[model samples]
Target: MHTPTIGDSVDVLDTPSMVVDVSIMDQNIAKMMKRFEDTRKHVRPHLKTVKSPLLAQRLLNAGARGCCVAKVSEAEVMAAAGITDLLITTEIIGTVKIGRLIDLVMKYPTVKVVVDSIYGANELNLAMQQFAPGMKLQVLVEINVGQNRTGIAPGSEAVGLAKHVGGLKHLRLVGVQGYEGHLQHLAKDERVRLCRTAMEKLSATVQQIKDEGLTLDIVTTGGTGTCEICAEFDCVTEVQPGSFVFMDAAYRNAIGTTYGNALSILSTVISRPATDRAVIDAGLKSLSNDSGNAEPKAYSSMRYRPAGDEHGILEWHDLDLRLDIGTRLELIPSHIDTTVNLFDVYYGIRNGIIEAIWPVSARGKVQ
Candidate 1:
């Protein structure tokens, strides 16, 4: 809620805050969308990274088909914010979550949920019939294509689930989602080879479902790492790439440094522990250490090491420049999604001046 006014200098903002370069972010969005402009595929940017509805609307305005959320609560927040079309990429089970899903469908007609089992489908169908009669929820069968996470097998298992969903009166089998999450961070050639194999499995599943007299309106898949290859596949109808808007060090290593580093933690040098080391105010609470430690921007010789909850150690090697006290340093996060959840608002910067303050509205809505 502490937002800086327009035209404020980035230095004037508080330390340990998240700031986004608006121009760079816009370019990233536009570039990703343009990659799919000529193809039949569309870009459905996931909101799990940038949890702000304002940013989601910006993506939609830039020609995104819709948005994807990881949980039902996230979908609820987006739907309440007037994002009509949304897809909850995770499966929703249990009675309470099922009721919430039904409520969400009642509120937003275009809402969709992924199902990996017939039990989940039946539970959702029964909930819809009891809570919101006459409302049909769009459902997608999640195929476990390489990522041994929360999806069924691609061939017969996927076809069986799709058939089960098709038989439900309150559930409509609209599409199938086969995410190659395990192959997202591989090198380009290996990533493409593995993704092609997975896509072939999913494509065969799509054909099998079609052979069963079922029409799949969508075949949603892919992330920022394999978006280009996935888009080229004739069977993929849409690509959901979230982290391209805010390129992090981990993704930069896997996908190459094509997009700008739009997100960074603005921190102040609080202590000079030694001649070869310094301490920053930001730590595990301010940034995410899930992928790896945050990298100091433009300081190639310096390395970041997490000290404690509120401290970070920065060690330098053969560096003549000294990080004196009160020096401001921008740390590029290692993982954009988890790092974004650590902050409440993003100080939008353009040309070294704060242009807007956008809240992370969907932050902590991870039910």
Candidate 2:
């Protein structure tokens, strides 16, 4: 299929293309920034959702402190695009990845990573010693508040890891990261309460580190669901909410935020099998199926169901709204991160016209 130019209308684009409304995205960014403007906390939006360098730079220009990536390759891509002040939210395990991390530290002055184990910290320190001697790699000790993921317990174990990383000459302990991943999808009241509990544990860990004469600069946590709650806490110096840039169905159902859904899969109706069923060109390959099927946006009664890798079935009870062979429909994906990774380019639309075609720069950089 031929690619559409910037001046082309979104209706002329190919089927199953990832589309982003630039105006709505700008509103989302402004809303997120305004949420923390009254507080002391800052926004460091995560790049895992929208992997485009242009979007990352846009977020930085909109008053975001920096960006966070899930892997070293994502950080490398961001660094090469002239984006500094990046944090690799996940730990770099092997020697090869640690070498890449060291290179990033040498190239970008403010590259940081999360360290949850002493072995990982020592290995990273040793690797940095060989590659970039005298250069300090900033580190944040990850505390497992409730996620039970890659973090130590929030009390002495966290403090002990901080001390270990602090003792290393090549690694500088910056702060702690305690992500409430499990509580992000809960209802409003329960989520806020559990988030407060998690923040309290993280704050206690910070105090433990401070009592040992260690300086903790940044206390980062929260996602799109709990950005407001995390901002209210004075201890959380930075918030890492990734999915706000492109709101998904899952996040929309969980949080009460006013952020609009700026992302959608523009699919064309290819077949009308029956009176009540229609099929689109986008399916599992175009939209993410991890969080159930994508939601139909145009018709209220239409229900989206994944048919296969290249087709989606839409069932509707209304007969007045007809879906012809060439009719185009917009679908709000359940998960934006995985859905975005399936496409190479994002058709940026504003006022029904294609404004720009942004490449998903860090799309497959899941190292």
Candidate 3:
């Protein structure tokens, strides 16, 4: 029942806590906005990374056009917090989710969603008709630009789907969403080259939809790695770069340090069993490892291996440090999205003092 209050020193927080340097995070956002200033696109940062409606508002205040959520459940949380300008990036199907979406839109009419299949679009359209009669749901046709994940094929397939959505009385086709997720972690040259190709296909598809006299007002796409390239492309109305706000080790390796690592998992050294090895209290449950193991911020020369759900083993082969029990160190997550989901709150710090404590509002909204 302890509440973390502002103005307290960050050291008062317990170890293995998720912390963010607000100054660095602000700089990251500023740098990202600068990159898109000269381009013909707006920023609609993806909410799957930060997951906090408070953070979403910060982005909106920082000149973002809107925000993107990966699920209808996530969209619900954001909309509840007055972030109605949301574009749910995933397809919403199933009667349960469609029912929820209908309820959500009844209150916040500005919420938009993406549809990859005609079945999903038709299902949503039917729900809108049944639940909210005479209401039109704004939707974007998702094109599989390169992710090969949840989108229709780019060229003719996208046009066909857009046309199909236009015919639905309860569904309105607004735009297209094509995320270059695969290129988000590639090398600079390779990322740029492949991202252009993906954007080319997406742009052409958007033009084709427009040429068919469809209502294609939005072409939402891109990620932190390819947001700049995506913004420079033709017909791209906005970019959805999520991870740039709190840069992770994986993105850092790919895109370099355009955005600083603003977040970390602070852990305490529990046991210095050996001269070269130390045990800490952060592990798989605290940090994500799907992308790679989290890196020790100050102990970059050391290798970190999760011992179990509660402990991490650190071994030093090159750099020697004064290691002792109760020593606290912060770890930069390899994947920010999954790691942030593991924590309930983010301790926002500035000059080693806590300035804010934001709840992860949409943490488990994976539906």
Candidate 4:
């Protein structure tokens, strides 16, 4: 645990490099781990948000049960890093990817996946047919918990799909996964209520399957915003939260949480051609603006304006600022997930000096 003192001579290497203060990142991880310390529900954090094997290792060190990724390739990277337990939490939607899934299972041997439909289950079944006998793929039935994005509808339809997937030769329905993504960012009370309602829907489906003489083991759901609420539900056996480890301005503004800001991009001021404005080297390509807000600055009046492809214009009307051309400024990202995807490596800094560099291992593992 290193503290950066005032006037410490830490060099800003590049114009638009992504940086993580290691001290802050450890604090963030500890805070989230504390939230799950006494709870019975396990924390299987989604690694899709960070997409870094190093970050995943940090979360595992902080008591994460395992990691949940969006793609097979992301799981492969984590598997190579010695993370044996993984849950692919998205609707794996192709035949080509099933081969990759087979390869991952062969390599790690302790992997599980979530699927919503009989079609996907059949594809997985076909892929695993060539494997050793009695070697089964654990599949979790994904229920449509109000998001309507994916997953089968809760009830008999969901139970039927689970039964079909379970009855398949090489696949077994181990549990159910429902992500209440729509309610994660709502107001606290509303988020709690809506997420509970969605989980209740999923829970009922799980019970229906159990009534059919089938045993369900794991029930996973929730994200950073509704982790506390989700953990309270009796049916939810585990919580899959990712952004809590490295929250951005959007989540902070939504929940008013005190989690330490772990991720930031350090950019250098390149132009100060005018008195009331300054320009930085990072622009739209480096940071995500989908949240429709500029990076909040410590000073209230200094607003960030997008000038061009490679420049961020700072609009400050009153002060006669005297920042040098090589001044370094930290920019908070609007969206942590997409912003992280833009960078290749994150410079982990401690006490204002680079301690380590970790590559974004799953940066382009889209499929």
Candidate 1 C-alpha lDDT tens digits along 1-367? 5557888888779889899999999999999998889898989999999999999999999999999999999988889998879989999999988878887788788999899998889999889888887888899999998899989998888899999999999888999999988998898889999999988888899999999999999899999998888777788899998999999988997788788889999998999978899999999998889899999997988899888989999998766778899999899999999999989999999899999898999999899
Cα error, residue 27 of model 3, in Å, equals 0.4
Task: Give the Cα error of residue 161 in candidate 1, in Å.
Answer: 1.0
In angstroms, the error of model 3 at 77 is 1.1
Candidate 3 accuracy as lDDT: 0.91
What clash pairs does model 4 have? Answer: none
Candidate 3 per-residue lDDT over residues 1-367, each given as its tens digit: 5556899888788879999999999999988888888777899999999999999999988889989999999999999998999998888889998999999999998999999998999899889989998789999999999888899998898899999999999998888899989899999999999999998999888888889998788999889989888887778889999999999999998889989999999999999988899999999999989999999999768989899999999999764578889888999999999999999999999999999999999998898
Q: Assess candidate 1 and give its lDDT.
A: 0.91
Worst 10 residues of 2 by lDDT: 226-235
Per-residue error at 131 for model 4, in Å?
4.5
lDDT of 2: 0.90
Candidate 4 per-residue C-alpha lDDT over 122-238 given as tens digits, one digit per residue, 9 for 90 to 100: 888887887634579888999998999988999999999989987999987889998888887798889888988887898788889999988788899988898788787788889
> What's the CA RMSD for each of the models?
1.2, 1.1, 1.2, 3.3
Q: Model 1: how far is 87 from its true place, Å?
A: 0.4
Ranking by lDDT: 3, 1, 2, 4
